[model samples]
Target: MLNVFTPNRHANNVLEIKPEELKERNIKGIITDLDNTLVAWDEPDAPEEIIEWFRKMGEAGIEIVIASNNNENRVKLFSEPLDKSFIHSARKPLALAFQKARKGMGLKKEEIIVVGDQLLTDVLGGNLAGYYTVLVTPIVETDGFWTRINRKIENLIKKRLKRKGKI
Candidate 1:
């Protein structure tokens, strides 16, 4: 199942993607991870580039919701518009959060894209929830004890996926 890890498809942290590309692909919403996928975990505020990207994506009519393992405080502080709802205290690698995020967007599984940096949590959870998954590179390498363990496991999956030529 970890064959879902696609390293080459990871977008730049600056969001090099054009909104039109996602629109043409029929993706109505994006469920993104908070820590590394959206911003550097240690960074206290969202960068100007990220703010612009979110604004552009919103202007293009795409719904974006954050599905983060971080606590509600962190997620709320991160996505300050308070306009879009998010799944905080999310226990990833579980389908519940993905389900909640998709339901929050009022979008079908097929119309949503789950973007994150981890294979086990992000890709696997997104796939299990029946949404398209986009695995991105970590925004910053340093992590907590638990996250370090998860990253190790994700690295193993990534190597196996590469051997299988799935990435």
Candidate 2:
């Protein structure tokens, strides 16, 4: 049960996940969370560094799909400008959205990585779907009301994982 919340890898931020390392691991596709994972939840656009990171991944022949539980308009607004694929209102930890994104990528299960800032949605969802998971630190300390609740729960889980040396 606790294993579902554990990420295969952790990074301080998305930028710390370099294209070179992914390429080395033969990672061809990424299904990543939109808000907080890529940028602040309330932030409207991608910053320059993030844009460059996307460009670098594209140049490395990696496909990216933005998967968010946020509304379609919000996800569409963010993804279209970057010319990336996306799945909105993902209902994650459910496997369907992750599978849809993987199918769209036309990649094998082992070739994709799932990344986000949350354990409940991202890590558990990715693990349940059998993808390599990367849990990046949330871009901001503050979260929306619901996320704050999730974070409190995550803290308890983290403590247990820490005690077991599984984090």
Candidate 3:
């Protein structure tokens, strides 16, 4: 099962990749997971570090759109303050959510990158959607049990990838 998947290309959890870097990869847009990927699970606003990252990516001309499974209230609460574009009720790992986010960004699956912290949801969802995936370590350590289980599985795959020098 692990052999059937592809983890993100970047090593760091910060996912501080700039627009130029994305452009080189031919990535015109981004579909990101909001909670643990960009902020702590319940953080209300973007931190300074996050704001800078957003500004940098924006200056690079990359459009940012969030694809999260969070509810409308949670999603809007997280996004409206940052004034960023995003989709709530993403239902990730399901290609439909990723597709919706991509469409909203005015980009195609091939040209968009999905950035998130989880393997089963974010990476799998992005892979299923046929977009390039970037996995980052979670910003906080508050994930649920099910998510924790998936991480363990992901770690095993990562270890194998490392042994083969594929990560």
Best by lDDT: 2
Leading candidate by TM-score: 2
Q: Candidate 1 residues 79-148, lDDT tens each?
A: 8764667889889878899888888888888788888888878877777777777877788998756789
Worst 10 residues of 3 by lDDT: 2-11
Best-to-worst TM-score order: 2, 1, 3
lDDT value, candidate 3, whole model: 0.79
Worst 10 residues of 2 by lDDT: 142-151
My TM-score estimates for the predictions, one after another, are: 0.91, 0.97, 0.86
Residue pairs that clash (backbone atoms under 3 angstroms), model 2: none
lDDT of 3 by residue, 1-167 (tens): 55335665654655566777788988888888887888887677778888787888888888889877878998898788878888888778888888777778788777888888887788888887787888887888877566777778878877887788766
**TM-score quality measure for candidate 3:** 0.86
| Model 3, residue 117: C-alpha shift (Å) | 0.7
| Candidate 1: regions farther than 4 A off | 4-8
